[model samples]
Target: MIFTIARKEFRSLFAAPSTWWMLALMQFLFAWFFFVRIDDYLQVQAQLTQLANAPGSTIAVASPLYSALALMLMLLIPLFTMRLIAEERRNRTWVLLLTAPVSVTHIVLGKFLGLMLLLVLIVAGSAIMLVTLLLGTHADLGLMLANILGVLLLSASYAALGLYFSALSKQPVIAAIGALGMSFGLWLLELSASDNRSFLRAISPNAHFQNLNMGLVNSADLIYFMLFTATLLWLTIRQLNDERRSS
Candidate 1:
């Protein structure tokens, strides 16, 4: 049943013309950044070769692309997730689910998974460009894999957070703004916090994502992403359960 809902939601997103437009725009932006990175890398290749411990092609090119993708995800995931529950409620479709036998947990998980599958498509598109680099130069497969894992986990966290905000309001615009504001604010906090041990920065997902971006795989960072994503998902489930009871 959860998978069914997920499949339906995934198909509905692609069915919308807006989704295609947004995807087109994102692809253009990603390709522009990717080509620019490659050009810059080529321009500096001579100088980098002279250094005792120069950064590899993966670090010089792929890493920055992933960094940009990370920022793009922060912006795009909220937009994608905004309609998850908010649109359903706005169109009076959510009421059907409320009256159905499906558990709140299933609904939230299904919605999140559906959106995540969409994100996977986006990540795969980005990976194609990254892999193309292998045709010209040797690529760091381990670092690339780590970055991929980091991106997937980061995007999932964004989706889960956005899902909670979507569950909070019936208006999609309000949901998008609220989710983006919270996600962006946390990202800003990661930059503004001076103390390394400050609780605010420590709690931000961007801080943990930076560690993964460095190709350092820590269990703690993995745990942080899991806990952050799970906490929001749990809150979303509670919100739905409350709504079901109230209705």
Candidate 2:
């Protein structure tokens, strides 16, 4: 049943013209940043070569590209997730979904999985661009894998957070704005900390992602993302259950 809902949600996304436009925009932005990174690397290649512990093309180019991609997706995800549940509520379909035979958990998980499938497409586009680096220079496969993992977790966090807001509001625009505000607020929290060891910095997704972007895959960061996503999903489920009981 979850798979059925997931497939339906995934297909519905493609049925909309906005999905196509978003995909195109994502690629265009990625390509522009990629070329800029290459140009910057080329200009500094000579100076880097003179240093004994110079960073390679992978660190110099690929790392920053993934970091930029992460930030870009951080902004774009709220737009994508805005309609997940909010649209249903606005269209008066929320009652039908709640009355369906499927459990609230399945509905929420299905929607999350659907969003994740779209995220895979976005990540794959960037991965292809990253792989091209291997043709001209030696790339760090380990670092690349770490970066991929980091971005996936980060993107999942964004989806989960947006999903909760989507469930909270009937209007898609309001959901988008609320999600964006919270996402940006968390980012600001990370930036406002006076020290790296501050509790505020520790709680922000950006700090953990930075560790992974640098290829340091700590257990704590992995745990943070999992807990963060699970908490949001759980809240979404509870919200739907309450709505069901009331209706």
* lDDT for position 152 in model 1: 97
**Candidate 1 per-residue C-alpha lDDT over 80-182 given as tens digits, one digit per residue, 9 for 90 to 100:** 8988999988999889988999999988888888999999999999998899989999899988998999999999999999999999999999999999999
Q: Which portions of model 2 miss their true places by more than 4 Å? A: none
- Candidate 1: the clashing residue pairs are none
With candidate 1 superimposed using the best TM-score fit, by how many Å does residue 50's alpha carbon deviate from the native? 0.8
lDDT of 2: 0.93
- lDDT at position 173, candidate 2: 97
Q: Estimate each model's TM-score.
A: 0.98, 0.98
Off by over 4 Å in 1: none
Model 1 residue 114 CA deviation in Å = 0.5
